[model samples]
Target: MTVRSDDTTLEITRVFDAPPARVFAAWLDLGQFQSWIGPEGIDCEVELLEPRVGGRYRLVMNTPERVIPVSGVFRSIEPCRRLVFTWGWEGDAIRQSLITLTFREIGGKTELTLRQEGLGSVESRDGHVRGWNSALNKLDHYLSGGARR
Candidate 1:
């Protein structure tokens, strides 16, 4: 309904060594996704990703400690510019929360702005903030090591 309807917002910023095109492809392609993405120290298996507007995908993360599942539906896809999607964890009753990622080029680098909104509560939003911070840091390393589509 409203941005951060629970009155909390999760925003994370990270710059990647790759261009926006390559970074975007890493999110769209399953093989590249499996290679990089997910919380630190967790393994991810993508069940599906349609990669087009209105397409949806489900991914399973099998951590040695626990398993987490997330599904997302693409809302917008502007090549090398922006992407918006609805994301929901498997066991959550509230679904269809939004995540918007914007890619801006600065001095031959891609600056990513990740914002996940509509968290139901302060706890949910806070948890996601920390999680995304970790995840994006990994993305930084992944790209730093020359990861590409």
Candidate 2:
């Protein structure tokens, strides 16, 4: 995994030992998403999921201390290629950000790139880097047939 970040944006690239279609399907599949979409050791709940453009979704991550609720609307979806969405914490609408994910096929594997912007501060961007890296690691493990959380 590689992560790059500036003052208000973050980019991550990772390679997964799965095809692009399977990798892309993970994001739209509520069951698969909840299994690997949070930091390691965190539990996730899918409150709502609508994978089409203009559709809304909600997820809750349960940490040891508290539950963090996140909500989003799908902006675009291109099967096996790309996805774009708006992301924000449930009660913090003003801090909404945009996330774009692109998947490319390489030698039967998937190269996934994620770009996120509109963070309120550098601290927020850094925090997302950590969270996303952990989440991606979990996703890789899941794709490799590891036990689900």
- lDDT (CA) per prediction: 0.79, 0.93
Candidate 1 lDDT tens digits, 3-114: 2324556777677888899888878887877766677767777889899999999989887888989998899999999999998989885844799999989788888888
Q: Candidate 2 residues 1-149, lDDT tens each? A: 78888899999999999999899989999889887888888888888989999999999998889989999999999999999999999888888999999999999999999999999899999999999999999999999998886
Candidate 1: C-alpha lDDT? 0.79
State candidate 1's TM-score: 0.87
Best by TM-score: 2
Best by lDDT: 2
TM-score of each: 0.87, 0.97
